[model samples]
Target chain A: MEENKKTCLHDKHVALGALMSPFGGFDMPIQYEGIIEEHNAVRNACGIFDVSHMGEVFISGPQADAYVNYIFTNDILSVEPGQCLYGMMLHEHGGTVDDLLVYKRNSNDYLLVINASNIDKDVAWIMKNAEGYDVVIDHRSDELGEIAVQGPLAEEIVQKVLGLSLSHLSFYTFGEFTIYGDKPAIISRTGYTGEDGFEIYTDHESTRRLWDELLAAGAKPCGLGCRDTLRFEVGLPLYGDELDDDITPVESGLSMFVKVDKPEFIGREAIIKQKEEGPKKKVVGLEILDRAIARHGAEVLDADDNVIGTVTTGYRGISVDKSIAMALIDARFAARDTQLKVRVRRKVFPAVVIAKKFYKKSYKK
Target chain B: MSKIYYAETHEYIRVEGNEGYVGITDYAQKALGNVVYVDMPEVGDEFEAGDDFGAIESVKAASDLICPASGEVVEVNDALVDNPRLINEDAMKNWIIKISISDEAELDDLMDLEAYEKYLESNPH
Candidate 1:
């Protein structure tokens, strides 16, 4: 295995006595104070996260828009500059490569924010698929640093601490700002936690200072542990767990982002066929009747102990206070009210098929 | 007076004659963070030594609770069903289960407090 990398805020996390672990090939902080505390803070008040490990690639050229549209599943033509769209990059076989957010800086320039674990693979895939497209694909995973300030009171904290105005920054939109008189930064009103938040992108030095500023301003410094729980509660898909090389976006219940009616794109034919015929497997939510959590890779079985599906992600919810899981199962058993059992360890837990969205998304739509 | 024996998996059994109160150690609870739920085995359920009887779930992860010695569960801590955080507050005071020892000789194979401390020192989490 290669040596794990550290983000610019590694020293800060250590000083805070955070529980550090290897995640996505980086020595990242899993928790600062505790996962439950940080999880509640993001749901109730405000929390700051060191998301510097996320990958960023810039695509710019005369044909950047066309190239990105061809590679991405969402319709980029509908969004204007400074707008963001969430979609997946799929292979010709309709399996997902990675789910990412694309920021339309302009007709010629676009910023693609990808998962940290998929940085190398995503960059290589983009470059390999850029054979005839007139575009410059620059992987900026290391040079740029990112932070997410999320929660209900996130706007208040960002406005008061950063001394920056975000009143006009609506959801899924970003704007460039000059911070501290000279440092230019990109602040986007977007997040993965299904809350009102902002993601700031800047240099490493600026990011370090900004983290300290957020702490001093009374925003809780959270880690990746609660980040997963918070995102899971609202049914947002994680990269490897929910969408992977073997899982297509259509089967992951993300077909809304896959524009089959759009004029020609990669995996369009396969995706269109899947949409017409319906995917063989579909993602659905299950509420376990027992307290045991049916974690990832746990088998979902039918009445006679036949394996019907597998769990993608599961959690004892902090906000909802219930044992819930999302599983990819046979499409025939994806309907609500269907009875299924999850094998957790040596025991099988009875669960009922429910809406995959355990908690309602509170995005400012 | 009760004699406490520790397992390498961090479970502790406080034995008083033929009865043993089984619970996780302070070290285990501290490592598990907030204890959200404790899946306890029902009374009269038999378990062999090192058998996984239940699980202790935290906000981030879940750990299986293994039996330290072969026994039959006589009582379970019903309080943990609603307030599992009691384990985090005080692991020893809030024992998870009470078992009637089926094999008292198994205690000889377990570690004492002194030996458990040494075992903990050799391994760091």
Candidate 2:
């Protein structure tokens, strides 16, 4: 493959002594201080991450709500102004095309944040299915960028740096905020990691300034390597891993987003059918019995040596003190405490099924 | 006296007076990126030099530890369980295992510090 692309903060990453690597068609920092150190920084204090590579699509026009509800698996009509809803964009066959969060800035304009690698395909899918809809879906990936400020003390640091008060910012809410005098930013109380955080969307040139400002305010710069580890520990689903084109939100235990009770939506009938008849397979969490890791594509086998499923994402849980993984297994064996074996390289290590979440999300009251 | 030998799988053993210390070289640890876990051998395990002894797991991958010399394990550094980083800190000082070398002649087949350093440069992981 060609070398991965670079983000707006590519030069800043190198100057901060980051280890560079390729991710999602971008040459990104795998770590700044190191994976463990950065991971700990975000868990304990606050960390600033250059997530500019995340794609943003602007969907507008009078028929925005109709277009969004038809494409995503959620009740787009229910999202209030200045609110965001998390859901999956499903294919006609009911499998996940991409998992995204659509922010309804108002009745007419909305923003969709999607996984970087799926941006092109997602736009293509939306446009292809947009027949007869009086709406415009514009790809704004290059026009704007994003940064995530996350951790326990993140809110205080954010208020201090941005000169704004977050006194009553409810979870999953967003607002138009000003930073650096004239630069405009959309601040959303959202994050992939199960922590207190905000995603700041701003113009491309202004993103680097915000990154430097946040860093100078004492927020440690983190990278995707620790970001993956952090999100894995929190048991978040990744697009290419715990989810994919062949995986449906219902089978992945995300039926909460696929509301069949809504008037009507894409993948609704298929999801309801699966709900009634039961899914063929389910995504499950695996806790390794030992230190041996179960990596992506590792086989999951039963006691009879029958192949049941494959590991999608695996990592060393710094807090849990053992290897953890998420695997999509036969529904019969998806229950917690089910005994299984993970084929790690040449060895078949024992594992056990557990709750869907590897770690609990401690949402602030 | 001192003698050195290596397993074809890239582990080194330094033998001295019926005893030897075992560890992967600096090159091996560097190749394994961010060591996370080191499964240590027990205090008393008998094994041939080329047998599968333990494992070293990094965030990116895992490699089996091969006995570099024929010996009975006398002691194992259990500290590496939580802090496998001891491997990267000082692979030689923080020996993974102490073994009672069963044979002295096996030392003649291994590389010395100079040869092993050259061996690492000549080959890449």
Candidate 3:
């Protein structure tokens, strides 16, 4: 078997006594102090995450504008330079290739940020589709390191610790600046956590320096364990859980991100058809009545004990303090207040269908 | 003082004559992190050695609690239903259940405190 890859901060995490685990082909930190403590830090105060494992691909050429719009589900033409749009890349059959953020640099330049687990497959898909377009595909997944500083106090912490002023950047917008003696860095007012934050992308050396400064400034160092809980609470979909190669954006309840109104794009017809006729299965939020957690792959059953669906992700919610889960079940049973049951281990617990957004998001905009 | 025996799976049985208090080891709780819930078998439930009695859930995942020996459950720790973090605070003090040993011979199969500590050193999680 091939050895797992390590991020630039692997040694730092180990030095802090982090519980290391394999995630998305990288040996990453699962927790520092504890998952619950780190989770609360992001929600209440400030937290820093080493997100260097995320992939970065640059597309440039005269045809970049049209090329990106054709490949991505969102309408990149609507956004101006220095702005970002969140959407998915879909197969012709409407299943998601990967959900990504497209940063519009200019008319002929754009940056695509993708999931770490789907780096190779996504780059290959992008390259294969570039055959007919006059665009340059620059796969730069290995050259950049990224970190996210998130929470309500992120703006102040970024300013005081990193010596960067983000007053000009709004939500989903980015700007280029020189840090550490003219080293170019990109700071974006974006984050997966449902809080006002910034994602900084820079070289490995600068990334390490920024991380140390933030930690010294009292920003909680978070790991993937809390990252999952934070994103799940806000209804943000993870790649392998809420979406995959076989799950369409519509089926995953992410229709808002898929611009089906666009005249030409891959999977447009399939998305339109699914919207018109409705999808066979829909992802819905569930609140398990009992204390037992309905983990991923647990069976969702009906009143008659008939199998209905499967849990995509679940947790004893740190913020909400409920046994909440997101499950993909038959569209017939997707209505709010619909009663369901989740079979966990030797016992079955009653559950009720709820809105996917278990906790109200606190976005700045 | 009662004798404590350890199973290979990390469960501990504190024996007092033929009755024993069963719970997970301190090492097991440390590995599991913040315990959110503990699934305990009801009184009078019978299990064979190596049978899965219940589960212990953390915020991230769930793990099964294996039976250390053949026994019938005499009592369950009801306090765990409302507050499961007791295990994290003190695993030895927060016994999950009280089981009446069906066969004392099964106790011989488990490891003593000294052997269990040695086993942990060799097989780290």
By TM-score, who's the top model here? 3
Predicted candidate 1 versus true structure: per-residue lDDT over A1-365, tens digit per residue: 79999999999999999999999999999999999999999988999999999999999999998999999999999989999999999999899999999999999799999999999999999999999999999988898899999999999888887798898988999998888679889899999898899999999989998899888988999999999999999999998898999889999999999998889788999998888899999999999998888889999998888999999999998888799999999999999999999998778989999987888878766
RMSD of 2: 3.8
- The lDDT per prediction is 0.93, 0.83, 0.93
Give the alpha carbon lDDT tens digit for every residue of A1-365 in model 3: 87889888889999999999999899999999999999999999999999999999999998998889999999999889999999999999999999999999888799999999999999999999888889999988788899999999899999997677787788999998899997888899999988889999998999999999999988999999999999999999999998999999999999998887788889999999999999999999999999899989999999999999999999999998999999999999999999999999878999999998988889777
Candidate 1 residue A225 C-alpha distance from true site, Å: 1.0
Name model 1 segments beyond 4 Å from true.
none
> Cα miss at A250, model 1 (Å)?
1.2
Q: Tell me the TM-score that candidate 2 gets on chain A alone.
A: 0.97
lDDT of 2 at A319: 55
Residue A319: error of model 3 in Å? Answer: 0.6
| Regions of model 3 farther than 4 Å from truth | none
lDDT of 3: 0.93
TM-score of chain A of 3: 0.99
Q: What TM-score does structure 1 among the candidates reach?
A: 0.96
Report how far residue B78 has shifted in candidate 3, in Å: 1.1
